[model samples]
Target: MAGQACLFCEIVKGERSAHVVMDAPDAVAFLDARPLFKGHTLLVPRDHYETLTDLPGEFLGPFFEHAQRLAGAMESVLGAAGSFVAMNNRVSQSVPHLHVHVVPRNRKDGLRGFFWPRQKYESDEEAADYAARLSGGLT
Candidate 1:
C-alpha cells in the first residue's frame, strides 16, 4: 500500500532529502533532523507500512538488521556508551510511517532525566563528523 504524503514515504521516493546512513533493498536508515543526541538516526522500510503490524515478516527482518548495524556505527562514530532503539505507534506516533529511532547515548550526556532532553551542539563540525563517520561505515 502507498503511504499518504508521509515524510518517510517522500524520503523513500526521493521526494525529500535526508542524510542517509544506510540503505538496503527493503530498509533505509538516515540521520534525524531533530536529533535527541549527537548521532540520532531513523530506520524505516521503503514500502509503506504505517505501523509494526503492517510490516511483512520479510521486510521487518531486514529493517531490524539494518537498524542494528546503524547502532553499531553510531557507537563507533560517537563514542556512545550505548544506544536506544524505539518506535511509537498510533497514539504515540508523531509520524504515520513505521520507523524506528536509533539514539546514541553517553553516560554524561544529561539524558538520564525522565524526559529525554536534547543538548545544544557547539558547532556543525561535530554534527558533520558524527554523520560522516557513521555513513562511512554504511558503505
Candidate 2:
C-alpha cells in the first residue's frame, strides 16, 4: 500500500495516471510528465521511499536492474544516442519519492551541465505513443 499523501505512492496504487513504460516487481518506470526530452523516464519503487537512503538494501539490486533496463530502452526504443540516469535525494527531489531519472540523450540536445530544461509532449496521444514504444523496447 502507498504512504499517505505521497504522490508516487498514489501512482503505484493506480489512483493517479502515469505514462507507465515498465511495471516490474520492484520498480515502476513511467515517462516524466514534464520531460527534459520526449523519452525521459522516471523509475520508482512500488512502495513509498522518500530518498535513496530510505530504500532498504534488499531492494537495491532489483530496483537498479529496472533502472538499467529503462536506460537501455532510451537508446534502443527511443532512438537516442545515449541516456542520462540520475537521482536526487531530499535536496532536489520534486515529489519526495525515490525516483531515478532516465533521460534520453543525443548530441546537441540542448541539455548542458546539471541544469535541466523541461518540455511538454505535443499531446497526450504523443506521450502515450512514447510510453508504448518504450514499453515494447523493454520487453
Error of 1 at 100 (Å): 0.6
Q: Each model's C-alpha lDDT?
A: 0.79, 0.90
How does each model score on TM-score?
Answer: 0.85, 0.95
Off by over 4 Å in 2: 1-4
- The number of the candidate with the highest TM-score is 2
Model 1: lDDT to the true structure? 0.79
Q: Write the per-residue lDDT of candidate 1 for residues 1-139, one digit (tens) a residue.
A: 3435689878877789776777667877777777888679889898878899998877767678888888887677667888988898877788888989999887787777457776545666666666678988752
Angstrom error of the Cα, residue 73, model 1: value is 0.9
Candidate 2 local lDDT, residue 69: 86
Backbone clash numbers for all candidates listed: 0, 0
Report the Cα lDDT for residue 59, model 2.
Answer: 95
